[model samples]
Target chain A: MYQLIDPILVAVLLLNFAALGASQLRTVIHAIALQGVLLGVLVVVAHNEFTIWAVLMACAAITLKGIFIPRLLFHAIREVSIRREVEPIIGFIASLLLGGLGTALAVLFSNTLPIAQEHVGSLIVPAALSTTLTGFLILTTRVKAITQVVGYLVLENGIFIFGMLLVEAMPFLVEIGVLLDLFVAIFVMGIIINRISREFSTVSTRNLSSLKE
Target chain B: MLISQIIVHVVLLLVMPPLLLGVIGKTKALFGGRVGPPLFQAFFDLIKLFQKGSVISSTTTWVFRAGPVVGLATAILAGLFIPFGGHASPVSFSGDLILFAYLFALGRFFTASAALDTGSAFEGMGAAREVTFSCLAEPALFFGFLVLAKLSGSLSLTAMLDGPMPNSWGAAGASLVLVAASLFIVLLVENSRIPFDDPNTHLELTMIHEVMVLDHSGPALGMILYGAAMKLFVMCALLLRIVAPFDSGNIWVDWGIFAVGMLALAMVIGVVESIMARFKLTFVPTFLVAACLLSAFGIILLLR
Candidate 1:
């Protein structure tokens, strides 16, 4: 499990960059889905003991986060009838350079923390921090509402990775709450996108500024 | 024995490059599900090129003729610094990595300038694109050198490359992985391979490197082709030295490993070309910048 954890974390890091630099909306969504699936696997592997609940929880997380959310995002895009372009407030290169800088800072910051015995050598801390920073960068920098939602998914994935440290301490109810919040967010956003496409004939969040304060 | 080593190095650098191009062609052909050109087709093309007459333009000056000659000279010159397989480079000194790197730039400068000297807007367009992209790519290559410098605690290409012995791989494996990925992207962009610029594109408007050489013919063109092939080999050698740093403690065995590693690198390049579409021209800088950041991250990993 330890051997596998580092590689999985590295894959997550790479996916974070892939999402950051991607020019198309579908590529970002795909990177997010693959990342969600990897985190699902991490949930099982992070546990010290193989409980039946962990396996069941992993499957449920994988199904919802990996399959259900991406499918919803794809459906929203299809309904919106917009092109696959990723219109970023910050250019792709700028965002990518910032993401790299953030990853470096995250790694450096994690190095200074006084971690406990079991988690001392694990990469979860920096990977979690970097993944979160990348998600936030995307969320703030991308103009499209759908891409912003994709950023939200990545942000949650980072928080999920960080949760591995307190796997035993964190209650099952808390995980359920986070997942429930995500589901509601996406479900409502999907409807909103559909509604926006119907009313304005477009889904660019920039257009919403037309409504006065 | 030193003289013999130098002789072997010279012979290998001069002779083995065309075969790698052949392997790449063969691999791409296999991907396209067709019987490709023979493995020695690059050599055959070179011979056929040299046998023909060159139609030098009256409008063009001597710089036009000097381009291929300078390009080939700089490429093979830089090839002397890379430690192939387990063997030390024949010509290496402190700070030679910098020289090795700028040798590439020097080669590009001459090639692009020569393209401009042709007074053709077409070649000038290609030259502009080539020089502009190198501006992005140069930093990535330098960042990679920084990672190597940090890892090996050496400045010369020979020592910087040799530092990644099997033991160092364990200590700095993560950083090395980042460097390798970055270097691979640089190789593709620098060599004009597909996914950055396709070497085989027939359309002048689409291809950056090929378009620049369109005005040259016969022996001058052969030098450019041979130079391009050698450039590919030299870049692959630098990459393979880092990623596949294997040694058996025998000179003969290490040389054999090198031959096999170059073949593998060419095939891997072919696979990448086949699977990935050429990035949009606008997106090329984005990838190059990503390459820079990747290696920068690699260097950051060493801070701990």
Candidate 2:
């Protein structure tokens, strides 16, 4: 179970960094979808004993996160004329550097804690947390609204990895509830992205500053 | 043992958040010139809202109703891990802080989603600002906790604070000021208070959390407002936990200090509210960024 969880978690973290480094909106979206699928696989493999209900929930979560949300966002991108993510607040190299720093920080911090070494492997929590922070950094640094949403998804993936630790402890009802909320959140954010594109004539969040006093 | 702990945890979990709100409200009022309404004002408000039926906007969907309940449930569940007075939390284990933080994000996500669901431009604007500031604020918060864990050499909040790690008043003071300041910004922003926002304001342009719930009424509205207040109190309690040097043995004295600290913090917020005007919207992020910088400073101080 630990082995199954570790590789995917690391891969997702790397993919999140890759998304941050990408200049194309389409590439970022694809990377996020890839992460969603990886997380879906993780949910299935990480648990000690997987029930049919767990499998179904994992599949549903994957379907929504991995497939449906990306498709909807792609459609929203098509509606908007802006296709490229030019002039990210941080350059690609800087972002990669920051992602590296974030990862190192996670590892360094996690090592000092009393968590048993054998439980989830050494890298899982720190890597996930670092990836989460990196995603957050990208979200704030990027000017494009779509990139921000991608950043949010990356952050969500990071949280999901951490959530794996307490699979036995947390009620499945709460898990499903959280998943449902994320689905609706992304669905609604996709709608808002479309509206923002139509209203502002660009997907850049910079334009939204017009309302400021 | 397990069953009793679970029961106790569940009961305390359910009861503490609302009472925290009551304490803050009463404290803020006392700080102002007048004697406030009863501390149970929130409970009274909840009851009144239950009796009154809602007036739903024709434009609104089921999303509006679902949003508040989702936010409240997420909050209550998240509260399970936060150690109030010094007992191991109900769901204590490694990486619990991550869940605690993310659960709050779950609340914000729903709140933002419901705001957008209304299709009102005002609500959308408020949601946008909320996300923007929180983006800066959340990392600062997590980093502060990371430093606290380092200082105490414990993973969970209950352990990190109550464990026998040597507490440096300087490091603790810096970190506490940093975290408390960041959380104070969060308290004002999350609760839609003055400076970040004016809770009393009806104009959509000036709204943060308020406009999001413009369409919700009755029990739903009550839950959202009460939940918002509870969130403020939760953050305050966390702040108090950082500042007040209460060991695991002296739980009663710790609870007393916690209560007193809660009032002091609320009074400080009220005073700040009375003195400050709402910052210009663009400038609000700058204020939050300042808090984030202070948190970073706190972390660096701990490292040194």
Candidate 3:
């Protein structure tokens, strides 16, 4: 059961990194939604126990991450008329290179840590860590505010993957609370993007430089 | 008693904010030319403001009213897990640090949202800058925590501290120094101290954290100020745990040393604030990126 869940999650995480390395706005949001769905499926499959709460959590994940968020973001993208994150401070190739380096580092670092739990599956820690780094890479390197939001979502997803390793230990209430906070956070980011677009006439954070000393 | 732990955590989490501010202020004053106010000055100020009340902005909604409360609440809530002086945290579990870190992010997210809610360009600029720096700083801070967890064999801040001090000045010492440097940068940027944004800066155009709080007054202002200082205190405590000589058994000595260390650290921050000019806003990100590189180096050293 652990082995089956691990590879699919790793593959999804890698795709999430690949998405971060992409330049198009539409592609990035879609990738984020895809990540949400992948994570949701992973949750259900790994637990291998079908309960109403679990199903509801999975549904909530799909609604917020897979559908609602991307739809809201795409609307904002259309409203702002900005289709691409052009000329990110780091080029796509460079971001991908860093992403690869980060993945290698994550695997290497995880190997060094002493593991106490015999039943614990491999790959979760490294996958989560690399996905997190890739998300940060996108966040720092991108000029677009929208893209940064995507990066943040990816980062949160990576954290969620990390959380799955200790799902039994972590309270369901806390999980619910985290998901609620994340949904609200993304909603707030959508609002901020709208304001940024209207005020500066561009969603590119590069132009919001009027306040710098 | 579990109940007592809960009570103590709650009280400390709430009251310590103002006390932390007072300590920071008094230390800064001692470092400067003049005498500072009493150690309880922030506490007094809060009482005064709470009694006096506030004038709501016309441009704002319920978000404005709820923002400061949420910020303060979240800060106090996150504080519940920080584990003062090797006391077991009220909440502890796997990946608790992620919650610890993100709870602060939760406060920040709300604070930024509230800042943007005001529709003031100055506040918006401040929010943008805060989030931008946080984007870089959060990872560095986490990476540092990661290394500490790795070295110590535990992720809980308390357990990590409970682990053996990395013997000698090798990779462990290097990483400790690296993490401390990065966390200190976070303390500055997150707390809105000098070289990042001057807490006492008169100019709104040059402010990040301060500018966001410009429109807030009375108890709301009190909460923001208190929250930032307590956060600084928490970071100081984490640093002390890293550097302190005693292990978990000598709680009194460890805490006493922590308090004294925090006082000295506050004075150092004050002296730095007194002497240095705020960096150009663009340079703030550069500064944070430098911290990230340091943290990355620390991790690489640990791996090697």
The digit string of per-residue lDDT tens for model 1 on A1-213 reads 666787788889989999999978889899999998998898888875678867776887899889999998888877775556556789889999899989989988998899888887678999999999998998888878888888888998999999988888877778778788889988888887777777778777888778767
lDDT of 3 by residue, A1-213 (tens): 564675466556547654755567887888888888888877776566887666777788788889888898899899999888888998765566577578768778877777547533366777788788877888888989989988888888889888877766777788889899998998898888889888889888888766957
* Model 2 chain A, TM-score vs. native: 0.92
The Cα error of candidate 2 at residue A117, in Å, is 37
Per TM-score, the best of the predicted structures is 1
The TM-score, computed over Cα atoms with residue i paired to residue i, of candidate 3 is 0.58
Can you tell me which runs of candidate 2 are displaced by over 4 Å? A1-213, B1-13, B16-32, B164-173, B248-250
What are the DockQ scores of the candidates, in order? 0.66, 0.02, 0.02
- Name the TM-score of candidate 2: 0.55
The 10-residue segment with the lowest total lDDT in model 1 chain A: A78-87
Model 2 over residues B1-304: C-alpha lDDT tens digits?
A: 2566567656655555566556655665766767877877777888898789998777878887789998888877776777664545667777788888888888999998999988987888888888887887787778778777777777787786555432545445545655666666766776677878887687657667777788888988888876776677667666666666565465556556556666777767767776778877765665565555446645744553
lDDT of 1 at B229: 96
Tens-digit lDDT string for candidate 3 (B57-150): 8989888777788888777777777776556677777678888899889888888888888999889898898888788889888888888888
* TM-score per model over all chains: 0.95, 0.55, 0.58
The lDDT of each candidate is 0.88, 0.73, 0.75
Chain B TM-score, candidates in order: 0.98, 0.87, 0.90
- Deviation (Å) of B141 in candidate 1: 1.4
